[model samples]
Target: MVGAFEQALLALMIFVIMLGMGASLTPRDFYLALKRPYGLAIGVVSQYGFMPFIGFLLITFLPLPSAVAVGVLIMSCMPGGTTSNIFTYFSKGNLALSVLMTVTSTVFGVLLIPILLLIYANALDLEIPRENIIATLVLLLVPVAIGMGLRRLNANGGAVTEFMGSLLAVFFIAFILISWVPRNWEFLLTTTPATYVASIALGVCGIAIGYAFARVLRLHPRNARTVALETGIQNGPLAIAIVAFTFSGTEAQSYMAVPALYSLFIVIVATCVTFIFRRANTAAEQKMPDGLL
Candidate 1:
């Protein structure tokens, strides 16, 4: 199990990270999302559709233990986080679409996550605590609601909070490295090769499929890149929070292995993906976004 201090730190990271995600949006964003609905469609098809199938295939083929397999399922089903938005900005992708997709996927996740978990968990004969996960996800929304209200009330304060959330999303990675990794160095070292491969492959495969899916639809290169990162880079902090809060002792640690490892590896994965995306940016595609990213 994660140490108490680490769990507390993880909770704080999630609260503010969610708050920032909330602050990044306004009421108009939702209106536009409904009007356009493009991002929403993409988010649902790519994230809720393909990603879980990928996870199911991975766990089915790989020799992951039951707890570790469930961990992978949870990671695979997560929504795109603010981390994807940051990467979309850096990659010169469609920031507006990225944010919309992140928000859309996350909102839809509240309904989809439990259903998806039940389907996959049942198929695999895994015992997932879906009710606990459901409660945690719903509770997590409180911060988003608060952040949105803050944004509506004070623009400057909202921006500061938004920036804090993105910065802390990155900082959460550092926290895991310094705080979680050291304490669990022995566990990490002893972890099987298959577990490591599953952790790393989830993001990599998700990105590849996302980019390809976007291209198939003839999306602009920037939008395609945005979809790719958003697809691959899931909300790791949320997954960690879910696992940390939902389970305990050896069982919790076993369940945490995939999410924790994925959180650590995804930064590296997204960095490389971002660089590739940056190179793919055409001068025309660079000018495609109407100034949102």
Candidate 2:
């Protein structure tokens, strides 16, 4: 069973993360969303649409345990993580579009996540508590609203948001290194190859499909890259919190494994993808005249 302290810690971490997200936002951010609604629309659709189906298909075909399958589904249904914003910046993608999509997806995820989980859980014959999921998602909005209010009132709120973002990254990396990975070392060693494939494929397909859809819809090249990163980097911490709250004992541990592993793997893959995009962008700049670039 997860200890009471651990549970409380997870809750606090998620709250801080959401607060940081809201603090990062401004009134102008919403204005941008309104100004270019199509990019946001395409991103939201790609995020909530094909990703869940990909998770469903993976678990359906692979011989994964029920807990692991449900974990993957939860991760799939989550919103885009702020990590995507970093990746988008490095890739020379549309940073504003990336942030807008992240905010929009997260807000929409409050409703869409539970609905998607219900649909996929039913299809897979997995038993999940819809009420608990709904309650947890609702709780997430409280801190976010508080942070947004702070940003609206204070001119220096961006500094606080940046601090929170740094804290989140540090806390996650420290927790995983000092606690989670050591505790789950045996499970990591014994995990099946198919499970690894599924986790990696989830991130891969998210990027590919998101970019493909955006390009098909004739979005700008920068917007297409932003969509891809946003789709690929899911809110793994949120998924972890959901699993931690919803399950206990061996079940909780089992369910937690997929998201934890995916979190680590996705970073590596996203880094590689960012590098490729950076090289391509550099090459394009060289090809263009001084003023054209």
Measured by lDDT, the strongest candidate is: 1
Give per-residue CA lDDT, model 1, range 1-293, as digits (tens): 68888888888889999999999989999998898766689989889998899899999999998889999999999999999999999998888899899999989999999999999999988999899999999999999999999999999999999999999999998988888788777888887788899999999999999999998988878788889999999999999999999999776777888999999999999999889877877677656644332
Clashing pairs in 1: none
Task: Assess every candidate by TM-score.
Answer: 0.96, 0.92
| Displacement of the residue 6 alpha carbon in candidate 2, Å | 3.0
**Candidate 2: pairs in clash:** none
The RMSD of every model to the true structure, in order and in angstroms, is: 1.7, 2.9
In order, candidate lDDTs are 0.90, 0.80
